[model samples]
Target: FEEINDELIYKKDFDIDTIKYAILSKLNPKYLGLSPEVIILEL
Candidate 1:
């Protein structure tokens, strides 16, 4: 995240893989897992 001219923006350098892994963990309650339903909203 970055603040520019009083507005916040998602940094292009942000690691997308990290976001995917986070979503995967949330969907997998039993243990570490991966799913095809992972959705990343880039802004």
Candidate 2:
């Protein structure tokens, strides 16, 4: 989470969409142990 935020902030021109995609990409793999289907549904 902090890493994703740092990546977004570090890239001076990052927008919300880019930040969201980056965070989701990073989280999805780590969160795979949980119910990804439910998570996606909620999101």
Candidate 3:
């Protein structure tokens, strides 16, 4: 993949862990096998 023009989309000024936890909590039970830490790392 080639790099396209990058843009600042959404901006967050909150804590990283709090944001990750919030996202993880909203996930479906089927995704329980995926570690929340892994998800954050892959983000």
Evaluated at residue 3, the lDDT of candidate 1 is 91
Q: Report the lDDT tens digits of candidate 2 across residue range 1-43.
A: 2367457434456566665566677674855655443222223
TM-score of 1: 0.40
Q: Name the candidate that leads on lDDT.
A: 1
Give one digit per residue, the lDDT tens place, for model 3 in 1-43. 2334774455456688877778877978686775546345535
After superposition, candidate 3 runs with Cα above 4 Å error: 1-12, 37-43
Candidates in order: C-alpha RMSD to true structure: 4.0, 9.2, 7.3
lDDT of 1: 0.69
lDDT score, candidate 2, position 23: 60
What is the alpha-carbon lDDT of model 3 when measured against the actual structure? 0.65
If scored against the real structure, what TM-score would every candidate get?
A: 0.40, 0.34, 0.41
**Which 10-residue window of candidate 1 scores lowest in summed lDDT?**
28-37
How many collisions between residues are there in candidate 3?
Answer: 0
**How many steric overlaps are in each model, in order?**
0, 0, 0
- The superposed Cα distance between candidate 3 and the true structure at residue 19, in angstroms, equals 0.3
Ranking by lDDT: 1, 3, 2
lDDT for each of the candidates?
0.69, 0.52, 0.65
| Candidate 2: clashing pairs of residues | none
| Winning candidate number (TM-score) | 3
